[model samples]
Target: MQNDIIKCGLTEQTDSQFVDSIEKEAYVWYEKNWKHDDYEHSHHRSQLTFVEEGYQYFHIDQKIYLVPQNHIIWIPSGKLHKITSEAQTVNLMVFLFKSVFKDDFYRDLQVFAVSAVLKEMLLYASKWSQSVTEDEEQDIFFKAILKSLPNFCKESNFLEIPVPKDERLIPVCHYINVNFKYNLDIDSLAEKGKMSVRSLQRIFKNETGITLQKYHQLIRILKSIELIDTKQYTLSQIAYLVGYQSLSAFTSSYFSIMKSKPKINKK
Candidate 1:
């Protein structure tokens, strides 16, 4: 076990024990730069992961969620999850809540956008060391974050892509992810799966709960979000890079999923 791992309040074991056994009601881990290679585990405490810089890929329940900067990920207690650190360095902060109030936020894994206020609060909370025991002042502060946490989840839910369990569509999913930059018509995609268009669509929808076309668009939009953060490409260039022919078409699709105009974050 590396000293940094222990310093960050994470048990050396990837698969954390799920017993009723958290020492405190709440605690925090910050300045966590250690990388876990597809660390799949679940524990008794609900966890919140925030990135101070860079993004990470979190695989939860056979789905892939990308947590970019200004976003947060919530993993409910006992939900099996894996964190795949990207090749780039990621500054991650994780908080565990052993005792939580009854709320829908803690029931499922989600990656959502948060307001600047909430981000600042979390950054401030990171000042406490992981070794710090339960204290009244710290407990009250965590309670306040928990109370306002729900309000911070004010974004749409199109950020994640469900991993298809069907053996037939597994290769198909991989193809789409790698070839998203090119124009992907249904006919070719169906051919790639070695099935008829109708059968492919049915299985794709059944496994992912999203239509083939919609899933394709969702991938493009997710890619565009990453491009947007780079501050290097214009909207038109990003749209073109992500397989869209025109800016308006890309904007329409992004707005439909995100429920807002594309606003570039200057920070």
Candidate 2:
């Protein structure tokens, strides 16, 4: 218990100096079929996590992100989040104290692409001992990494899966998740939630940071990606399978969300 506490940046007090004070640190875990089910919590520092082997699910601020392998997940300081995984995974979590960043530090959850160079750097950082040595070479190395973070972020729309905190919206979100293939609209969702269209619109937009219609589209897009991975569904088939009646419309929406056209491989 004490070891876990100290590793997680919690500390006890001592006479002259505080025990377990950390500036920057990293911890890596390799697990087979690992799963964590913890309530939402916050940290005093920002965190960058690399999913090396399998995917991870992060619930933050009533939104869920499916961070797949070889991706990076950034949770800014004080943001409430919880993580869970159901597959064999290797996760490297690097915690950077707020003091390390000078200004314009990220304040929200961000999932972005990780470059090969950045991946190597994170791997090396994770190998550092608990008691990091204060050396000039280490200082230069960490400084370079801090300066490179913003550039590492992929300039693309992330999958912010809706998980509303409002009790009224929970059932609505679930319905949309399961029935994304159906033609869903604000009115349908409003009716399902027993609220006026305008009221539902306001609440959904406020809680999810997206309109009801757009959120539905995002759900379909995420589902389409999963289907695409099977290598069985043609682009047109996937389009209709995820609720897009028109092939052209589905292609446009897929391209808009994925920033690329859907590829159908011929086997």
Candidate 3:
């Protein structure tokens, strides 16, 4: 139930030092069992998160994203976010200041599929705490990994949910993002979107592939994850922030969706 904060600096001879030796390099791989008391606030850093085991909900801006094994979450520098994991899971994380990578490489925040090569590279980087002599090799390998990242523009249509092109749905989705804390339902959302309930439901389902209620749940859960990952607020505080009437209700819904209780750790 303790909140642990480990800052990796270049001058420090800790596990993060191997990463620190490389200009703009920051990487850490560790296992931890996090409890309800562990909450974190968002801070500025370009980060890449890869989960080798378990499931997690990641919240960024007002969107909730489901992350599973071999799936990576990339946080742009300065973007606010949090994470909530299903259990004690093995996760590999790389943090960079963005200035380290070439300018064009760091343009957007995205989650990409991890290839076998990238996975092995992560494994090597995780072992950095064990060897300082591998600093040169690690630096070269890290750059190669970054260079191998697929450009978004080239494969923009891959696995990403495109924002609706419809103008009517735009304002509705925007309102939902801004007011997720409110009890928003089809009727209320329809009224706000200036459409009939039936039409709203149809359009929303077509655009997002889920019902309105389910979508809202997804959004709420994602937000909760962000709050947890960043250590920004307590579980009770996050529960209320996402519009749950009770902590138990929030916990139940979270477990139902993620298939496990909220816990964070290295697998």
lDDT of 1 by residue, 128-227 (tens): 7474576888889888987788877865467777888888897787788888888667888888889999999999999999987777777887788777
The TM-scores, one per candidate, come to 0.84, 0.70, 0.52
Once fitted onto the true fold, the runs of candidate 2 whose alpha carbons sit more than 4 angstroms away are: 1-38, 85-99, 123-139, 154-157, 226-240, 245-251, 261-267
- Please list the C-alpha lDDT of all candidates, in the order they appear: 0.76, 0.68, 0.60
The CA root-mean-square deviation of candidate 3, after full C-alpha superposition on the true structure, stands at 10.4
Top model by lDDT, which number? 1
lDDT of 2 by residue, 140-231 (tens): 66677767888888754456677777899987888999999998866777888899999999998898788888888888987776676566
Query: Against the true structure, candidate 1 has what lDDT?
Result: 0.76
Tell me the number of clashing residue pairs for each predicted model. 0, 0, 13
Clashes of 3: 13
Best by TM-score: 1
Rate residue 71 of model 2 by lDDT. Answer: 74
* RMSD, one per candidate, in order: 3.2, 5.5, 10.4
lDDT of candidate 1 at residue 40, scale 0 to 100:
67
